[model samples]
Target chain A: MTTVIRELGDEQRELVLNMGPHHPSTHGVLRFVLHTDGEVMRKAVPEIGYLHRGLEKIAESTTYPGYVPYTDRVNYLEAMFANEAFSKAIESLSDIEVPERAQYLRAIAGELNRIASHNITIGCITMDLGAITPFVHLLRERETINDLIEALCGQRVTHHYVRIGGVAYDADDNWLKQVEKFLNHFEAIIEELDNLIVYNEILVKRMADVAVITADDAVGFGLVGPNLRASGVDWDLRRDMPYGIYPKLDFDVPIGAGEKGTVGDCFDRFVVRVRELKQSCRIIRQCINNIPDGDIIGNVSRKIKPPKGEVYSCVEGARGELGVYVVSDGTEKPYRVKWRSGSFSAMSIIEHISEGLMIADLVAVIATLDVIAPETDR
Target chain B: MTSEALIDYVKGLLGDKTKWADPEAGDNFLTVASEDWKNICQTLATDKKCSLTYLRNFTGTDYPEDDEIELTAHTFSYSEKHGLIIKTRISREAAVCDTLSKIWPAAIWYEREIFDLLGVSFNNHPDLRRILMPEDWVGHPLRKDYKQQETYRGIPTTRPA
Candidate 1:
């Protein structure tokens, strides 16, 4: 690694700088060896694996149903998506039919989790830019959603809500009422947040036209969710692939329109996430009103030993496409389990995009992409 | 194109170089030899009808019982909204295959990860190193026959059961 960095540095008299295996702005336990000639970076080589816990290896030893809680640890910010993806994989392997009401409940939980996740991404972008006030306001709104999720799943962060065939718990009338109320109130909160910091001059100046990723590059690098959409790609797994109750829900997939600057820039990524928060609220509102009364879990067997086969199931996670590839060998435990996370792919693109970018703008790019360390390392 | 038609199209393009797995099962893929892996991927990426621009998921699985390791690349087309899975296997003794990083930039890290955990090496990959594990880590941990090291740089890796 040193030889490679020296080879790149020898071209010009460059200063080598090490930024965090512990830097707050690097997101989590990520280190970048930067080759910079005083503030402009020639290359930023990201060094990862600080948070890798061998979740895939552990899955080979754990029972099919016992691995649900571990998926929560994959991406704690959007634990519902991880849980749903794993559950869908198992269901697909076994050909278990999830109850209609359970599908609606899973969608509701997932959207609420999406809103909570976007709150952190938008808040952290502003916070990383030195505007601390917006983070406080966003966290306040996130707390209400977290409290609502706690009520729904009986756990706060790592809610193991989705089971193999269906969901673990069902939503009652009172919980639905609270979710509706929160969506009604969150609509205005988003407007307030936009006014407070999203449209602030300093934030826009720091973010707009910085680290622009073109549409073709985005597709080639396999950017998903908001990052891909910000690059002007019209694709969303929920809409294009149509999983669960997303096909039944009526909502719009908001793409980057370059409202503030050039398309696929940092500002566009930030704005696309902000718009997604509203869209998530819209989807949750629809789910709340249209939830039906039925069984939450299906008639799944006690021993979940699916026939020998393999399946790849994914969900539109908070960050992007969170996928689980399961290869079962007619056993109670999974033969092999591989996670395809969005952050891992997003992190790989940093070396390509970080060329010629200022040190501070790199922070903006990482924050705007919302690359969570656990998801990337997992 | 649908999964069936996609398999047929790829079979027609690659002819004897590829063999299409039965589409009746889950995720039917085209099985190609190790030498033909890069050529088939290049054909898929550049072909006007296929044009699989996005490499959705790329991973490797260890099957020591069969004395072989399988690598799977799941490629998707944004314009057509269709996807195809490609599988290639190499002997466990010689786990080397041609890299697809030239075709899709997304394959760089994915190839490195497969090299890191499953002990598969990609030929001509720009940078192939341990990704999710330490550089000095001993053996591939994802392999079914792997044994955990007692300690790493004086830090114990195992705990009491």
Candidate 2:
């Protein structure tokens, strides 16, 4: 093979490079305009909106009930959270009461979605860092969770399972049994994943102490979920705000202690998600064991016309605190709907923090942050 | 501090700057003049009694009847565990307000988004450009009166039926 090369002059100038919009590691058509001095990155400006479908604009035109499926497009990775956030916004606006059984189902489905999301986060991060085996292993576990979710909700990616008042359907005993079996098996697989990737020497070196974000910075940037907890913020909407059935379920909110690296580093972020995976399993097990029997749906009006008011409903999604702000003008269609996505703010901090890191480490930073482009652009 | 106390604190801090306070809206909702938007945001974010360090959401809603666009900001204090919503109304003709990007870095993107979608401009924003739309795209799509262009660069803008 013939190679074409250009000789560098004595003058040193920064090289500006475009990373994605099509690159696999960019994760959903996200582009990074990187300024690099050789291997070191001087600045990384993330150019998003490639996936912007005007979801907020769509929400305004669609009726309250008609918008549930559209919410899935906001963050397909954790569609249940978006569904719950939108539905909860409607329920709050219309004064509808969700049944207890439905609340339990929401918790169960939400936790399972969290696990599935974390699987992709962990697997993709590992794969991006050059390890292929762990990605396959993680995907194998993810497929099992997807099967369980598909059985419960009847769809895989955009499971429009949650409704305005409650879930689409109640979990049968068979589905609950499958979830219980999956949780038991998932516990062992998580340990296997940890052994395979977390403690691996190369992965640790690549992630640990790279792209460190302080607790102050995390709070200022509005980081949430594992990213915020990894920085030692000790805040989780499920625990702090106590929405849905989160209060009834007992599970530990994992915070990064920096056991293997500096606190708030990329490694800590990765570890936080792994710990959350285990915690999610614990919550799912508890939800299955103590699930109460009742109506799946609530006494919500089928017309779905909320009075003239506004409401903001938030859920601790797989990525972070996903909030849906809905404004109703005494009409079937919402006046305006704003999706306050955690990934949007998380992605904003990249420019500030990417100044000193190497070009390769930026990938680790991006992966650890788990910035899903659709959610950010939405 | 409880949400009520936070509301009282903000009401006392801003005093006459606050146009109205809606206690029924929940989350300490208050509407203030566009001129005092930045000052109120700074106070809410930095004040110890109301350390609303988190800028949860920033968006603009078009109210055609009022001939103004209402800019709403939701802030949360992790330490206090309380939240507040502040609204500022700007005339639709000159929809400009001081940016809170300085107070909360997260507002940078939010401001750009509001600017891109609602045609509201945020003065003093470090980088004010269309975020979710193409640079060449015309009109703010989220505006109530916006009319979708038939074509862009001679390409059909709508799906062919």
Candidate 3:
């Protein structure tokens, strides 16, 4: 089976390598077709749809409330954002007002989910860069957040906590106290993890100055979330678009500062997520301190039939802007539902940036971009 | 700027090439003529005042009842901090519409996704291929009247229903 073949024409000599619908570093059932010239890649075209579950088509058949659980599968890593985006779209169309307490609860759950998602993102990137210890440490910290989330909502990964009009369940005072306790302990854990990987010379050398996305290119390509911010673009839907309780809460939006290398490089992307972790902690702290006491759910009917209209709602997911566009024809089920995900836009930019990059560096680009398969394929 | 002002600003720039639709039941959107789809988008991206540089979202919905597929391009201006929805309806049979990928690179994959799912082909698209569905799939899955193939490469798509 191992036979040597003679080389032919130059065009034919360029090897086409398949980088897995199963590759560990490729991250979640995604395949990349790499056109390589020896060790250097000419371009890496992403071949997706392995995880496509016809989710949008399914939305047409399911009722508004029934669709909440399905949105969880859209981006399992940041399921809270998917849930919130869909719920917000429905709520906006139906004119259902959530109680102040539910808004605070939703924000609290969202920020905590953001932290957990970023933990996995940073951990996976470091792990892909050959730093396993940091990934292990971050995973340990993530479990504590998961435990706190479990205390609030039963499930760990897909909380399904953010429902249309409001969150499914309310957090008890004890659970809120545990969240505060976790945040205090997790602040030191972030510092410890930073020491383990962020500033490490080896990881910096691997990521810094690689795949620098210009601010213009970032905006033009529709890159969202940290990936867009990593390119030094000061556009965050949470602040700029302002939804739910975000207008009342105070938190800083972190952008790429080029501490290790040029702005918008892989290093900047990594650093931005780390900075965002601190901001998420701050937002969660405020939500806990200023949370109002009231009804957890809104005055939504058991059977929600929104008026005939089309609305677009977005939330800042861990990856980027997770938006849900819904067209309701005065029915319980949506007429049309389209998801605009951060990873979907992030995936589109790869073929543009992967040119002339070392084959090994592609992993870093994929990691920093944080393009999850479920989000992209959904 | 507010959404109303932004719509008016865009209308003033485009002149007679587009029509502003004030749907009695739903939200308002700028509907561009089929021939002027690409021209209007190019202007929106390049015009100094209407710098909708970012193509936030592009989607195609099949409206079989109307015998047309509505393509909506949601554009946002990073500099101006405003956004407007541009929509155009093309005949479902023809399904050919101007591509926005040349103006906004983000639309490249989005157009492909629409083409693959809803069967709306974008003219002059760089690489128009099946994105979410298989290349040899029988029909556009998102179409309201789409029929599921009995089998894909000998693998049954549905349990004996």
In candidate 2, the second chain superimposes onto the true chain B with a TM-score of 0.92
Expressed as tens digits, the lDDT of each residue in A1-70 for candidate 2 is 1122233477656777888878878889888888777799888999988889989888878888999999
Model 2 / residue A353 / CA error / Å: 0.5
* Consecutive 10-residue window with the lowest summed lDDT within model 3 chain B: B19-28
Over the stretch A165-238, how does candidate 1's per-residue lDDT look in tens digits?
A: 89988888998999988888999998988888888999999988999999998988889999999999988999
CA displacement after TM-score superposition, residue B27 of candidate 1 (Å): 1.5
Q: Give candidate 3's whole-model lDDT.
A: 0.90
Model 3, stretches more than 4 Å misplaced? Answer: A1-12, B24-26
What TM-score would each prediction reach against the true structure?
A: 0.97, 0.96, 0.97
Candidate 3, A1-378: lDDT as tens digits: 112233557746677788988898988998888888788988899999999999999998999999999999998888888999999998888889999999999899999899999999999999999989888888888899888888888999888898888988988899999999999999988787777778999999999999999998999899998999999999898899898899998889999988888999999999999999999999999999999888998988899999887988889989888988899999889999999999999999999999999999999999999989988999
Q: How well docked is model 3, in DockQ terms?
A: 0.71
Model 1 CA lDDT for position A36: 88
lDDT value for model 2:
0.88
